[model samples]
Target: MNSDPNNQNNFEHSEYFDKENIHHKMEPVTAAFIALIGIFIFYQVGGAILTILIFGFNFENADINAMRLLTMGGQILLMLLPTLIFARFVYPHHITQILRAKLPQAKEVGIFIVGLILLLPLLQSFMILQNNLLEQISSTFPLLKQLMNLLDQMDKLLEKTYSSLLKSHSFFEGSFVVFLTAVVPAICE
Candidate 1:
């Protein structure tokens, strides 16, 4: 193992109990609460902005299919931007510490790649299961149905934005254009 400044001295001393070396030692419950709040705020603000940009600006009664495509493009950006920002700035230390801990291990890298490949199918399965579960719950519970309705409203807002955009350009072109807009800011940042 290579000697890392963050972990080497502690390993030498065998003082594994030391909390100082741990990155972000806040309680899991506290972190979960914060994450929920963050999700709520991000969805409300990001969803609103995406809807306005995609749907509100391109006010017309033309091609519905085109508008659908643009709304999808907007939704993708809305979902991705928050996650990228958090990873790059708000939680950069976590990524650095993880990389340092794992540091250039061929076996670890191989395992990680294999795990990621496996996870793709698992994630799709999970999404399918989540949708089915939500459907069942909505049928059984009024509150679940209400929550689903709220989600539907958000989806409609996103779709309206997409439809507006599609009216102007092909779906691929619109997505590529929006992606370029995002990339410029990312590069500058």
Candidate 2:
């Protein structure tokens, strides 16, 4: 019968805000959309401003190490931060559960490693076959070639960015590159 919505007893007894249960929070799709918007705003706007502040307008010509640091920082800020925020909004009290706040089992780790090793050759072979098929199809369809050209431009840009980020000047730089490309994304994505 408490009139105040902020009353602890009222919130505690409310089915929707039950502390013991993780349901009745925001819709998963709604939370996903919010996170997507956050990613766009953070990556496109905040990231651009940060880039300019760090390397000025000519960021393309910035030092490689600086660019690597920027890429890592941006991933943490724009990707991981938004994801955490999404968890907080959707599962307030159960954020850890939502984010899988636990170490993986050794068996799980082994399976993941073995899966990656086994999948690589299969994937490479598939890619070769796919490319050959696509080439044949594109030869008969000019529109497909134009679409492929657009995709190739995007792929080239991504490759250039990855290549730039992977460059290292020392052992420490190489270690950081691995952390940035491997560890950070493993946690973020």
- Looking at model 2, residue 42 earns an lDDT score of 73
* Worst 10 contiguous positions by lDDT, candidate 2: 11-20
Considering every candidate listed, which one attains the maximal lDDT? Answer: 2
lDDT of 1 by residue, 1-189 (tens): 334667635553444333356455456467557646775576668755765666565445635654554445444555445545554443345544432332446787899999999999999999999999999989999998999999988688667755554343577776755654455334322
Q: Per-residue lDDT of 21-101 in model 2, one digit per residue for the tens?
A: 776377888878877887877777987789878888654578887788788889898888888877887787777555644
- Prediction 2 TM-score vs. true: 0.67
Indicate the worst ten consecutive residues by lDDT in candidate 1: 95-104
Candidates' C-alpha lDDT:
0.59, 0.79
lDDT of 2 at 179: 96
TM-score of each: 0.39, 0.67
